[model samples]
Target: MTAPSPTPSIDTLERRFSDFATLGEALDFAATGKRGLNFHDMRGNLARSYPFSEMRSDALEMAYRLIAHGIQPTDRIALVAETGPDFAALFFGCIYAGAWPVPLPLPTSFGGKESYIDQLKVQLQSSDPKILFFPEELSEMAGEAAAQCSVEGIGWTSFADRIALKCELPVQHTDATCYLQYSSGSTRFPHGVAVTHKALLNNLSAHAHGMQLEATDRCVSWLPWYHDMGLVGCFLSVVANQVSTDYMKTEDFARRPLAWLDMISRADGSVISYSPTFGYDICARRISSQTHVSERFQLGHWRLAGNGADMIRPDVMQGFVDAFGEAGFNARAFLPSYGLAEATLAVSIMPPGEGIRVELVEESELTGMPGAPDRPKRYRAIVNCGKAVKDMTIEVRDENGAILPDRAIGKVWCTGPSLMEGYFRDPEATAACMKDGWLDTGDMGYLSDGYIYVVGRAKDMIIINGKNHWPQDIEWAVEQLPGFKSGDIAAFAITNGGEETPAVLVQCRTSDEDERTKLREQIRDKVRSVTGMNCVVELVPPRTLPRTSSGKLSRTKARNLYLSGEIQPYAVAA
Candidate 1:
């Protein structure tokens, strides 16, 4: 057995000089190398490892089996994205079989069975997969969800056994449809973003160039395979560049995040890994709780400590650096980036070695609100997300569709080869985001000397710890209460102690103090049931929430009023 080493002795593979036109070519090139994927358990012990050569061989064989089972080229094959060798082989197998693979999320941190089932059904309906493959452990849930969408569902073991090997693998073109990436926030509703082979390869190439990846570079990731950052940035990018990677499931990392650092410390090569701001916060908090945090981890070789996926918190980044700085961790290793699933992965990445840069601008300037200069001024620290990746162009446009000048925040627009083709079978949704060739990212940000600084989201989406939670979804869950009405609840994000968390303000009618407290607890439980978030539930007087001119509940206005202290809660304890 080959012992696990960060920089194991193996034949060096030649790097691809030219960019691959498709993932197939990329994987074929990677198979020439000795580097591949290494899976690990929560304890940081190696579970299994597969070199690129073995991965490609197994994938090709599985592709033949899938083809023999009448899975036509470009057919939809949905897989429950579990972090294991099965998912690894099946993902590549779909690529080899010329089938468009749709990676669905496993159980999330918050949502329970019903919420997960609802999410699965929505994605299944949107993707319209011909078959859904899941591990045996999740067979009942996956099969039930697949049945709801009228699709065939098979467990991994049965799926492999049932496949025949009488037919040949289908040829995949460079420009063919590669996979469908559904946005994380689309669980309440699903719109499958269609990414082509050319688009994926373009993004992968941009990642390789942006990161300045080298042969000796290794990766450690605990991000879910369903997430774009995990699938493309961590998994596929390494494959394209022939870099070894250590994998821990997202749940595993959630339970024991220090394992990620442990793996990094053991690896005898340069390390590259990325996470959202919350991930850094979680790790820092976990370490703080320990009585005697060891100094065994060596992060001196950690080259790219990336922060992205949601809003980047400078304070959180500082906390992480402070906690690990003594253990050979460098503050300059943090690489703040900005991107979305619609763009395939990265639009902008902080230049290597530049580290985190913050601009402390007046709050009035960012919000376009007039304020007395003589008054105690409030400032917001916006972290620079760096310049656009190779070949990607970014523009900030105002509400009227006119492009804004630099440093003026507006809707972030991007146009690049990595942009998605469109939403699968949903031209209306596609038309809403795509105009001409540019994609409206639905994110608000600004640019200064080519460096991008994201301020907030254009939509009423509350992102807590990198996980997306739609305000409407939270409100709907609360509305299920006996006394609550549809428009009586509002959910939004609030910054507390340098961390962004969800806060729901409810318009209550009753004045009974005990009754109201019970109601507040009920709302919290309901929201938690749906979103898996423990939000600050505040009961406000009726009509406290602002409404748009059309009489619709304006969550933005409500949030603004709450932050400005204009909307006071009644009979509520903070």
Candidate 2:
């Protein structure tokens, strides 16, 4: 028995685009060749490689077994998406069985068991899946959550063991529902984004043409498959193009982020990968502590280092480039893009090789309010996310629904073939966002020269006295302090005595009363100087702030907890 090769080339197949009516067809075509997936361990060692041909056979058999188990066409089956051969085969099996696969997230290390169980139950209730498949380690918790939703839960081994008889598989159509994507509950509760096979294929095809993907392109990823960026961009896109990919579990990457780069560096082929801003931040921090990163990792071959899934931070991108540039990394490799689950994945991607463009706008002008007074005397660097992808239209509209001119911040909306059919079984929620034919993105941004620059979320914008203030601006100001880090503070507007005031919550690590008081004063002063207003500053212990399933700071949740008194502030003695 031989260990899997670190750099395995699977270019025996030709690159195909826009040829498949559904993902099942894409997989069927990919299986005809030898290209497939490789799984890597935590220490950057390959554990297994499952060719698409073998995977298709396993899935086909499993599809018949699912039919024997009484699953019908369009039936929903939830699968805890873990990066392994089991999940890979099961995901394809559900497709072949003509059933919709609802991908759920695994338990995060930061959240305790109760949090994960609650999240799971909420999603299960929303999707109402017929059965849930989970890894053996999480079977107990998955069972508890499934029971709460009145669904059946079984471990992967048990699922395999129950395949007693074979039956004919169902046929899937291009217009049929493909899967349910539950949005990461960052600003609010998670909603299931219903996508169709046509929408999925359209988005994937746009990705191929937009990126100019080639046969030799290799994808290395540790993004959780439950996320749209991971599922569509990394997993499905690679399979559709017959490109080889190396994957490490999201949990493994959290522990050893360098392993992700190790796979890329060890690859003697061109590498394409994407991650949020935090991923780059964590990796840069980890490598800063390492004295020999240059001797160990090679990044010159990293052709497309994509940034998405959240707000792209230019500072973080620069830090990563600086940290790894010595090892043959190029700053131009940074590909900043904009997307959401509602669009089925990417809507706009930076042109190939033109990385991280910034447009400096006057801070006060970002609010787009007429005759607005308070000028912050600062400029905000809004990163250009790039032009809309093929066949996608982006428009910036004012609150009155009128299209705004370029450089005027307004609600971001898009209409495209890749847009979701609607939210699953929630007509009210779907109607609220879908108007006419365009999908209201609920995000605030502006367009300049046909390029989109996202400023902030409309739901999270803090409006005080008719002037718009972004919580990110306030949080970023406080983070300028030497001891502060990203996501260490939360800022929002609070109602006080018939007027709205700014409230800032900071996570302090010090217990010394004087030091705590000094920190609070420093944060207060910084915010005041930036916004020209006095603010309420509360000092809470570190780790008290809340994060989304995808690890983004949840300002709405933070405000709720603070207002509800769930977060107790440190006592400041005079």
Would you list the C-alpha lDDT of every candidate in the order shown? 0.85, 0.83
lDDT, residue 241, candidate 1? 70
| Tens-place lDDT digits, model 1, residues 1-574 | 7775432423466676228877878889888877788889898888788888888887777788778767888899999999887887888889999999999999776666777888899899888889999999988788999998999998977766754564666677978889998777656667788999888888888888888876667888998889889888888787777788888888889889888888888776788989988888887877764524446678899999999988888888998987888778899999999988889999999999999999998887766666666779899999999999998999999999999999888899999999999999989989999998999998888989999899988888788767777787888888888988888998988877666778999988988888898998898898888888788888999888889999999988888888777898874545
Please tell me which predicted candidate would have the highest TM-score against the true structure.
1
How far off is residue 558 in model 1, in Å?
Answer: 1.4
Every model's TM-score: 0.95, 0.82
Task: Specify the highest-lDDT model's number.
Answer: 1
Write model 2 residue lDDT over 1-574, tens digit each, in one string.
Answer: 8766533464556679856998999999988887788898899788988887878888887787788888888889999999888888888889999999999988755346765787788788889899999999997899899988889998977777765466766778999999998865421245789999999999988888888786678889998888888899989888777778889998898899988888899875788988888788888988755567779889998999998866676888898988898889888988888888899988999998999899887755764433335634657678999889988999999999999998888999999999999999989989999998899998999999999999867777664422345677778778989899998999987757634578999999988999988888888888766555678899999999999999999987887788767899998886
Cα shift from native, residue 336, model 1 (Å) = 0.9
Q: Clashing residue pairs, candidate 2?
A: none
The lowest-lDDT stretch of 10 consecutive residues in candidate 1 is 4-13
